[model samples]
Target chain A: MAHIELKNIRKSFGLVDVIKGVDLEIFSGEFMVFVGPSGCGKSTLLRLMAGLEDITSGEMSFDGTLVNALAPSRRGIAMVFQSYALYPHMTVYENMAFGMQLAKSSKEAIQERVEKAAELLQITPYLSRLPKQLSGGQRQRVAIGRAIVRDPKVFLFDEPLSNLDAALRVATRLEIAKLHHAMNSATMVYVTHDQVEAMTLADRICVLRDGLVEQVGTPLELYENPQSLFVAGFIGSPKMNFLNGEIASKFGANTIGIRSEHIEIADRDGSWKGKVVHSESLGSDSFVYVDIGMSGDPVIVRQEGTRHHNPDDAISIAPIPGKIYRFDAAGKPLKH
Target chain B: MTLDLWTITKRTAFYALVVFIVFVAVFPFYYAILTSFKSGTDLFRVTYWPVSFSWDNYISVLSTGSFPRNLLNSVFVASVTVLAALFLAITASFALSRVRFRGRSLLLMTILAVSMFPQIAVLAGLFEVIRFLGIYNTPWALIFSYTIFTLPFTVWVLTTFMRDLPIEIEEAAIVDGATPWIIIWRVFLPLLWPALVTTGLLAFIAAWNEFLFALTFTSSNATRTVPVAIALLSGGSQYEIPWGNIMAASVIVTVPLVVLVLIFQRKIISGLTAGGVKG
Candidate 1:
């Protein structure tokens, strides 16, 4: 419902700055995810946007109106905490109804909104049950339902799926995606350390490191052309293996980078030779860890399914020429 | 066979130790009740039970002595003390436990010091202050005095309970547009029922059994609490100690507290243990 803009926002606890000066703009209805490791200030950035924390310096504008002094409720935002934060003493219905009650909405309106939310969340059967009685997944739904009843301009989720088990997290993640589609007008900002959730849920992922934005781009864009080694290593699982090597040959100043999946594995005839250190088979694809002599690091090559490779096997690998990414010594991406 | 014998001996020793501890803890109260039932001459007779049963002690203690009035006084003081102490302590503890503000640690330390100061150390100064305030012989004097002993412990104990509450619940309320006050009143207070009851009961017992302040402050039957009145009931003239009337009055005063303890014994133990361990 609103585009949120943060201009040079900064925060500090005494002298220790947790959030350095950073600027970001979340367009209307965008599903923006802030992803970083623990203590990297991702959660703090989300909290700052939600008005849960004060912006020490800078301007936060909602829909082009400066809302730096606005209270969280007045800002028309709802946050679902990582803990699910359901009211243990209240039933699911009351938990969802709480915000409307505080806003002094009519009883019929509160009931209508709550029931609609409960139904949308498939939690109608659990409306009368207390939070303690519900399982973690159900409690998460109730927390989401509570946020939905507010019908705010933006929804803030602080690692909302972190507490759920693997299966439940997947289910809840899908539910959130559907919910966003249903409420297409509302802007949503989610923070998570889980890269898969970030990749799957975000319209654009904001990769952060040490209180600074490392890169902000579409998931595939960040994946295919990461600006820095930090983003390169961070965005993927079985993290992209980094091999230290001289340029050997370069076209002008461009430094080449190659991903594991693009490297060709052959029985013989390749640019690089190494003994296979390890191999992981996933049935659909396999990863071959090759120890190139004196490279001081193993290059992980992703091979197509049915490739036969094992540890201690001699192998030849080479980058699929055009697939390599080139970067400068400063880690800036260079044109091919 | 040897292992079985060793295990049997270990079990027997454990039971024996438990019995010994229980007897040591309970025997004094038992002796007090037994002494209260006996006649003055029979009190020193080295007997556990009364030789002759008599309702005369109960009758005299209830009608002719200050025991009845003092029992009523103690009830009023304890009830008022518990109500006021819990009312302020709950709110104060919630603030101390949940809120972030300047001087919060200092405020907590000051409250903790109130509970730590010996009652005897403050007796003379408090007596003068109470007299100067012109509430010396009144229930208000005892009520205020009892708060000194109850509030700090109440706040400290309830703070531990409040801290153990899930922080997310409070944050949920905040996101629901609840101000700090509403969060404390609607969310935190309801969840704190168990802690409140535990603290209130402890405060009541503390106020009810308090003797030094009550004895020093109140001189007349009108305002003297149960303990002082019971101590003063020695045949009305102090020449002969009226053991029977004392015993009957003591039994009357103690029965309610004993029953309360029995009812909430588990909770009391848990609350105390939580305080000790958490602190």
Candidate 2:
């Protein structure tokens, strides 16, 4: 395992910069994840670390040694592409064994390593089958197994679970968690657009936007104390509701922020009043979209399953005391 | 009842149109085969079939001094041309399809232009070069000439095939630490077998049937390909054509091609359809 450090890394395609200067430190054995919307350059940043792409500008080091000019293989990294890029012509065993064969390993060693990887991935039954013959989940396992056989210092997953169905995605997500546990010493970096995957898999999540790092912290930390509106909106599903209300009467200029789940609904006597514009019930919880008399879009309020609300119903809402976050107009959090 | 009647009429018309097209396409080859079995006089007798079938025409054509040598020369030249063209084309097409180097678009455009050019435009220049190189009357001259005609088409066809291959497979090879060369040979090339066969067979037939350059450049019987040999076959001089011998030689030259087409016709059609429809 090796610590990877990126110093002032930047990427540009012609005149358009995809990854603005960013510095990050990924500790040895950490399962760091980069999460962002499409075209935000999370995958590009991962590719830069894998050496699949040139650095363009900046220094990247592995284990305290500069590896900016090294090839992917020479850098001792294995990447599992989002497409499960298994060799179609080769059997699963051969696909896993390919790197060792290229390195001229002994036949017994190759066979042993391939079988071990297959066992870990629970793909031993598919060792003799071609990639097209396997199911999507099986092909993904083989893609991961191919990486496992290489025994690289780092493992790179570029949205590897995005292609699987929901049930399989959960099952495979668990399998990956178990695999990471089993190979606890190997550093793994994952890139995904799915916030759930990022929240579930990452030891620390790096949220990116427009080629710059928005925030980097533990999933819950980002969820609880997002430094900017981008991270606040990006880290949660149904996205954290944003209302365009200025400090009506600020407690020392602290512009208040509150998550939907933190707001309580009442018939009267609350800090804000709105008409409930929409309601979505998911059995356990419900979301009430309220058209507050504020300047912009409606605010969403997460209500308990028992709370009854309907469209166009007048409602009053207020933050549970001390649950509100205050942020400046620049969108940076301002301590209350 | 109306629907059934409509279906039957449509089916009948379709089959009728198909049969008419087949007859038009196949009658000349059928006539050539029948004529090859006739004697010299029977060829002009205006009969659909020979009164008596004989092997004499086949024997005459096969034994006529330079016919056998010319046939052998054609076989050697066409085979070498197909092999060399396919080999270079496979490598070139893979590079063009998968690599992202500068000038790739320009290179592809150049190949397409070469594929479209009329062979006659390059004939004089090529002829002088071949003569200067002193391979004018040898199989090398025909092989070299065939490459100019066939390589670009082969490359163009194979490049289209290579590009259709999934990019993920190449990425898999790269992550497995396979170099670009290994990825091309081990992964891309094996998956490209059908395309190679299709392109190689097309090149072979084109080289086999080429006449204009072959007739102009090759002087001796030792270097003549089948088309020129069949075209020049006559009774003693230009006064009378040896229809029987000519027909026999034509049938021989075409039989292998017919078999090849029949075997791979489905693949060729599908390949062409995919190339046209997808892009």
lDDT of each: 0.84, 0.85
lDDT of 2 by residue, A1-336 (tens): 989999999999888899999899999999999999999999999989888778889999999999999978888999888888777667888889999998889999999999999999899999998777778888888989999999999999999988889999999999989999999999999999999999998999999999999999999999999999778888887677665445323533334557888888865444678798888888899888888877766788898785667788888887677877666678787775
Q: How high is the DockQ of candidate 2? A: 0.39
The regions of model 2 sitting more than 4 angstroms off are: A246-255, A267-269, A304-307, B1-12, B49-51, B236-238, B266-279
Model 1 interface RMSD over true interface Cα atoms: 7.1
Q: Please give, for residues B46-79, the per-residue lDDT of candidate 1 as tens digits.
A: 7766565557678878888567788889889999
Q: Lowest-scoring 10 consecutive residues by lDDT in candidate 2 chain B? A: B270-279
Candidate 2 lDDT over B1-279, as tens digits, reads 999999999999999999999999999998888888998577787667547699899999999768988888888988999999988898899889988899998998998888777888888899899999998888898898899789888999899989988776676677677898898888777777788888888899999999998898899877898899888887888798888899999999999898888887665443221211111
lDDT of 1 at B247: 74
Scored against the true structure, residue B91 in model 1 reaches a CA lDDT of: 84
Q: What is the Cα-based lDDT of residue B54 in candidate 1? A: 55
Residue B203 lDDT, candidate 1, scale 0-100: 94
Superposition-based RMSD of candidate 2 using all C-alpha atoms, in angstroms: 3.2
